[model samples]
Target chain A: MSEFDLIGRYFAALGPERSDVVLGVGDDCALLEIPAGQTLAVSIDTLASGVHFFADCDPEHIGHKSLAVGLSDLAAMGAEPAWATLALTLPESDENWIRAFATGFGRLASAHGMRLVGGDTTRGPLSVAVQVHGLVPTGAAIRRSGARPGEAIFVSGTLGDAGLALRRKLAGEPVAPELWHRLECPEPRVALGRHLRGIASAMIDLSDGLAGDLGHILAASAVGAELELERLPLTSWVAEVVAATDDWSLPLASGDDYELCFCVPPAHIPVVERLSETLGLTLTQVGWIRSDAGLDVRRPDGGQLRMPARGYDHFPAANDGAD
Target chain B: MSEFDLIGRYFAALGPERSDVVLGVGDDCALLEIPAGQTLAVSIDTLASGVHFFADCDPEHIGHKSLAVGLSDLAAMGAEPAWATLALTLPESDENWIRAFATGFGRLASAHGMRLVGGDTTRGPLSVAVQVHGLVPTGAAIRRSGARPGEAIFVSGTLGDAGLALRRKLAGEPVAPELWHRLECPEPRVALGRHLRGIASAMIDLSDGLAGDLGHILAASAVGAELELERLPLTSWVAEVVAATDDWSLPLASGDDYELCFCVPPAHIPVVERLSETLGLTLTQVGWIRSDAGLDVRRPDGGQLRMPARGYDHFPAANDGAD
Candidate 1:
């Protein structure tokens, strides 16, 4: 396959078009419009073949997951996604792989009204880098440092299913179809994140699991959290396994959930709960913020569950439970 | 070195803080302000090691050239660059190499008043993908489709110095410091491009030499071009070599020139010429747009110069004269 064939997805057959994009592709640059009183939110992520996923995994899943991780960041910022540019590196130009990748990326982008503007496809080891641009009304973006000491910590949707699937796959065990789906197509919580601007004090997407991602909010806000072990929103499979083994790694240390972990002030709890009900999402109140700067996990018997004191690191140990 | 150390260029040690960036690194996304009445120009490019550059090339030059290519795209649109995001993949982290790379990248970014807003770092074969965002007044961006049949074609600076350096290095010949610098740190034509907004009918950066890059302008404008073989701006070394060997590949088909090739209407030619003089740049008038849809190279004796018909390709054979 020629480079032109792979790049055709942008100039001829990409998804969606926005009024804001004056020049979409095939230009030196894509010209975009940002309305007055709005801030542009930009997020970039790279998914390496062996580091992030198995090289033999479906290219469609690689496309979906690569874009989803960045969209999850936009969602955490309470921004509306508008455009994305991709930098794809491939060892060889595989026509079928490019088609399947475009299929996955275009479908998700069209669902959110996001447009693929411009990109460069080069020759190299397989890797995908996606940068997404979003819009939010100025002063309304949710930041990690806005969580007050007395705010309530909340999470939307079930967690750990993707992590469980990854663990199973790495262990050479057969994963259930539903669990595998969660790993391959973790949806970005865009709808809920857009609605969280006024209600949530601080927000972050759970890309690196609860313990590491939530720790960012705590450190940034100069507050702590006390989480209830039983209050976490978990799938039946993860919950049963954790309860039987007395292990919390599935829900706490594992990553790739793509769910939203947020902090809402006590005063806005009722409002956010109502909004979650309207959106038909399970809004679990798992914890509360504290004045002291530490995280405490309370067990059902009222004893503290101890874990390591760590946030995010650039490179982590292989078996640290984060893929 | 840990991933944290490699990614710290954005969070702590990168240069130049711009007022337009509201929230930079250490957050879910970078929040930026794009003033109304302006359009945002975006361009993304990836430089894969062993393909774009030798695997053992100086890491500092790799950083400089990677960002420079993306900046060249923004310059072609006559936009003022504001921010950039990088997604870097590396097989391993080398602290000294990273520091030198940051120094090279930071110096250029600070020169343009562009900020490093956010990015991702991961483990993989070495590759650097930089996406630059710029601002231009609404409807003022220079597009390749704007050129007319009667427009005069011009280019900034000399061409083929980088291509000569590459050819020499590959053939195990001595390369002068001046020519090697051309390959290592080719400057983007930002200064010349910014001043040609209204004066130029169409513009593009000569990253892929005249034959290929000019073909883009011709194809986009649906016009042909008549280029004068004697009028090409060539350095002393390249001129001597071409005169002795009768080889036109270096000046016509090689890539990585990083100069501006633009079209100006007959009436605006003098205006752009005077502006180039004021800017202290050598602006050479090498060609003119024609009504017919094919490229013609006229020799000094009035005969047509015959060469292959080709534009840019994602991947080409090793000896295509493009680096």
Candidate 2:
């Protein structure tokens, strides 16, 4: 069958039905109605085989990660999920692979109330490009430049399991099943982001590690930060691994965590603590924004510890990942 | 430099400024404000290195064509272009190539009053995926299912030059300069499309040849069509080539013309004729919609001609490019 026909049969019906979608699949363009007094949030991400995932990884996992990455961006902006479009390139037409991928994609899409509107399929090396569209109240989006000096820095969920899992898998070492799952399907904190829309002063999603991503907020806000190393949240698996190996860098500088790192005024700590308990999720206070102009990692004894300036660089040779 | 640094230096400044864009580059997500009473129109298209164009083709042309394809879908929907996001994947970082590409992309974006909101850059086999968003009046979008019997069929501009140019280039034959230009930089009829918003009964853009694309409209409308072979608008170059080769199929079955094929009530023909004169474009009366359930091409001598059922399929071995 033709690529177009294959898409219509396997992927068209995957999109959830919605009233706001005036036009969906089978049209040149999809029409969406954005309510008055709302702003549309847009982000795009592309994941390539071998570079973004193992070539032999499950197609379902690939699909989940592809959409999750884009949604994570929406979450960081405190936007409610709405619609998405996928541009998929495949090496060949494989029916089984397509079916499994669509299942994974549809499951997450339906859960978040996002609908697939339009996309194109082409022939090439395997890669998935997803563009997500969401809506937020006008002027209510959490921005990277809104943090101020004396604000407390916060991070949602645990960190470093995905990077650790990747390292162990690459080195031919067996990893715990929980760590493996973390690597395969990281959760995006969409609900927490929505709840924090007016409370958090600044926010970002940690796809490229906590240190590097926080550095973006600092640079954009023109402030500095001092992170408490002992307070950095880690999963049991990551903590055990770090204690045995005497390496604290993975949780601090690893990539692909997909958690939200945000900032709030110091006076709002009590409210945030209550929110963390209510959600049954760990919201760790790891640092504080400062008036100075550089980042510092502080030890329990109040001394500074030497660390790398940044995180995983896609172009490792240039060490350019540091902001 | 890292992928992020390369993007910051090259593409971060490519987007033009607009008031509706609440946020642009360097954010987790870009924020856009859709005006009240307007619907957002979305479309996506991807171009692979070898599948869509020559692997070593000019980066400038690739950039222009990539955005143009997505813009064409918006044009077919009769939406006014507003914003676009690009997800670019490259085999390696080449500063010169990146500069040329941004120049081409930014030029077209400025002309159409569209802003580049946000996107991701990744390392992989070369591909360019663009998602375009536009605004249209709610409930007034032109759709493929609106055609009725006895309506006059209209096509904007000439067709088949891109496909003909592709064939010549593949065969290593000398092609006319105008034909080569048409293949590389076909224009999207955005202005004409906006003008035909309420006038056209059904509308679609010609991407995969007239025969195959029109079939989409026929299937959606549950109708058939009959075309006059001699009435098709062809450029001087295409006409000369057809006369010498006796090949009418090029204009009928070739793809990538990027022209509009629309249907209008017979009574509205005079208004459209005036529109064509005012716009300085040739809007030819190519055919008419019918109540029957099959497509037909009539010769000048009033005889039916046999033609292929569809046009170029991506998969030639399976003849899947044909509709």
Candidate 3:
């Protein structure tokens, strides 16, 4: 099909004007009118083949994962998902691949109430870059600089599953289907982030490993952190599976978790509990914001735990890196 | 250097914040608040190496050209450029390339008063996609559907020079350095677009060749066109060059001419002339919108001009059923 016809058939399916979107997916440009008394939060993320994902991963999962990575940023700021634009580079224009990608991307977009407003498709090696925009009430966004010295550190959902699942996939192990699913599709904790907006002092999504990502919050706020290794919130199934293996480091330094981590004041403990129960989500208090400038881990026996502190660095792997 | 360190040193330099920019680059997300009574006009364009430019093109020009492409979209909507976000895909982390790119990008951005807001950098084959946001007063945007029959079709600047320059560069012709510069740095007419906000009925940027792009305005407005080929505004040098060439097809149908083509009512001709002189830009009447649905080009001898229609199509060349 011609490029225009292809776009009209496949891409036009991604958007149609909704009440909030003044214009969607057509013409020379897209028009949007932000609602009064609100701030627009914008973030962009790019995922490359063999860099952000495995070389043989499913195309549908890649589509879902690309949008999810950008959504995670919005979740971190407690913003309501609004609109998105995509830039897809492909080696060839495959009709089947385009249809499947649009379907997967459309599903996530509909779920999050995000309008796929515009994008560009071109011939190149496979990669997907998405820019997402969200809305938050005036001055109400939960920034990383808002954390205080005595605030309680919390994380949603289990950690290291995504990283561990990736390892299993790479090793070609006979793992359960759930492992593949976890490695393929990650759910960004958007509802939990919104619930924590008014209560949490600081927030961020765990794209890099939790140990590394938490450091971002600390550095941004110019504060420090104390993490309890025993309280790291590993799932029972994960614990059992790792007990049979010698290496458990993946769980601690695995990236692509898409989980929310935030700092909340001591006084809001009861309110946070209520929110967790209401959202039907697990919220584990794993650490505390420190007055000092370095991160330290405490063990179950109250001994200091030394961690090499490495995660997914965008550059080549080096031994001396911290997080 | 690691992606984190590279971002800290170079990517962060693109953003240090400025007036009219509520938030600049950095943080988990960038925040921007559109002015009250203004509508945000956004456009996205992706440029892939070997597709948009030659493999040996300078990194600095590539960065500048990428932004220019998106900015032209804003000019079509008669919107004032405000901010932009970039998504860069590279084959490897090259520090020198990144520095040169930032330098070129920063020069244009500073000159246009556009702030770099948010972006993503990833490892992949070379590609640069930018999304630009412009502010236009509500109800004042010049859309593609507003042209009425009998409106004068006008274009700013000479056509086909960029495409011709590219041919010259590809053939290693070293006539003048300015010709090569024009091929690499075709500036978007931002001031002209903003000034024409109340004057033009329908407007569009000519990136996809005059015939193909002007057809868009025709199709969207549900109208037709009659072009006077003799009236096409070409530089004296370009006219002489095309007259001697065996085929003037590339000059007519080749893409990458980032000039503004617009439709204005006959009553506004005096104002257009005044504005053209004031801005020191030559605005020439090229054609007229009609009630019929087919394009007709009138030659200088009052005969029909049958020109081959060619422009950049994303699908493989064979898909044109040269398949």
Candidate 4:
């Protein structure tokens, strides 16, 4: 079968049932009927080999991670995903690789109720881009600039697992199978985002490490913060993984953790805990939004914590002195 | 400067008014507020070096053509383009190349009232993918499956100019500058599409040649058609250019013509003419939908105009055994 035919079979299965999706994947252009009271949320992300992912990574993991990254955007906005479009470029047409990648992508998409509406598949070096669309009620969506000086910063789930997993993979260590899965398929906090929609003031997904991603909220809102290093909700597994390594800094600064880091007024922390219980999601308070213009760090001994400040920069480290 | 910084300087200038774009290019996700009574029409296209374009073509042309191809999709759906997301892959960052490309792309996008809402730029072999979204009234979309057997087939503007331009460029022929511009910067029929919203029964953009693109409408509607050679509206320039060639076959079979090809019921002919007058877009009657299972072409002498039945196929072309 031709590439179009192959996509027709598998790609159309990614859309979730929505009133606006009048026509789904089988056309020249996808037709959508935006309902009366909703705004569309759109995000596009592309992962390229040697920059975003390893050249020799499994194709299935690559497919899964691409979808997760796009979904992470919807999570940031507290929007319910409606549809997704995929553009896949491959070095060459290999039937086995395409099949595995499609299957992996389909599994994750189905799990999240995302429909594949339309896309283009072409010949090129391996890269995948997913453009995701979601619907949020008008005037109700969270944004990065909504945080206030008195707000408390919170993050869903633990960080550093993905970063540590990448470290293990890069070092050719005999990492646990779970570590590989965490590195390959980090979950975007979709359900948590939906549940926290009305409560969170500012929200963003942690793709560029906690420090950098949090910095976005600060920069956008014109505020800064102080985070207690001991209060960071690192999983025991992450602690163990880092304890085995001489340098665990990358786990704190490297990226690919598809978790939600958000802020809420201190008065809403009770409501946040209540929503977390209702959704069965963990909400950890890590820092406080401050009126100051720079980031500060605190340690468990009540002393100031000093560490190198660095995160994922799109350019090489020489330009920013990141390494 | 890195790719992101480059986007910040040049490409970001095409953004819409802040009020119009609820969320703009710098966010993790961009949000668009669809007015109370609008539907979204979306299409995606990928252009890869040595596949969709020549390896040494001007980067400016490539960028312009990429946006034009996606805009053509909106034309097919009879929707007003409002936003576009660009995904660009580069082997290395070239400041001059990106600046020239952005200049061409931004000019075209602004002309069509499309905002560069968001996109991703990455390091890889050169590739460009664009996803465009347009708005239409509720329940007023023109789709490829809506044509009936007796509908009239029409094409906007001329066909095969881009293909001929490519041929001339390949042969290093000195063609008129206008023809080269047509090849590089073909316009998408946005206003014509909006005028045709309720009149066109089935529609598709002519990117994959007339025969192949018409095949999409036929396959979707479960009908077929015949074309009258004498009625084909080949431009005078194309006729002059191809007069010495073996045939004017590429005019009907070669791809990359961004004009809109659509079907309308015979009764809507007056409406189409009025639309053409109002929008200043040509509406030429090229053929008619048929009940037959396959396509047929009639010659001027009432003989068979036996053109080769082919379109842009990705796989290697097997010898047809005609010899």
lDDT of each: 0.86, 0.87, 0.80, 0.79
Clashing pairs in 4: A14-A114, A14-A115, A14-A116, A15-A115, A15-A116
CA-based DockQ, model 1: 0.65
Q: Across residues A1-323, which tens digit of lDDT does each residue of candidate 3 receive?
A: 66666667877756434676666676678889899998888898888888888766777888889899888899999988888888887777778888878887888878888888888888887888898988888788888888899899999988888777777767877657776676678887878877777899999888878777887788789988898877877866567665677344555667888998899999998888888899888898999998887678786668875554444676664334554
Please report, as a value between 0 and 1, the fraction of native contacts recovered by candidate 1: 0.83
User: lDDT tens string, model 4, A122-184?
Assistant: 767888988999888887788999889989999887788778777777788776787667778
Better-scoring candidate (lDDT), 1 or 3: 1
Alpha-carbon runs more than 4 Å astray in model 3: A241-248, A306-311, A317-319, B306-310, B317-323
Better of 1 and 2 by lDDT: 2
| Candidate ordering by TM-score (highest first) | 2, 1, 3, 4
Native contacts kept, each candidate? 0.83, 0.85, 0.73, 0.59
DockQ of each: 0.65, 0.78, 0.67, 0.57
The residue-by-residue lDDT of candidate 2 on A160-259, one tens digit each, is 9899999999999998888987888888889888989889999999998888888889889999999997898988888887788766667888888999
Q: What is the C-alpha local distance difference test score of candidate 4? A: 0.79
- Report RMSD (Å) for each prediction in the order shown: 2.2, 1.8, 2.2, 2.7
TM-score of each: 0.96, 0.97, 0.95, 0.93
User: Looking at candidate 1, what is the lDDT of residue B64?
Assistant: 88
Best by DockQ: 2
TM-score of the B chain in model 2? 0.96
- Displacement of residue A224 (Cα, Å) in model 4 is 0.7
Best by lDDT: 2
lDDT score of residue A7 within candidate 1? 83
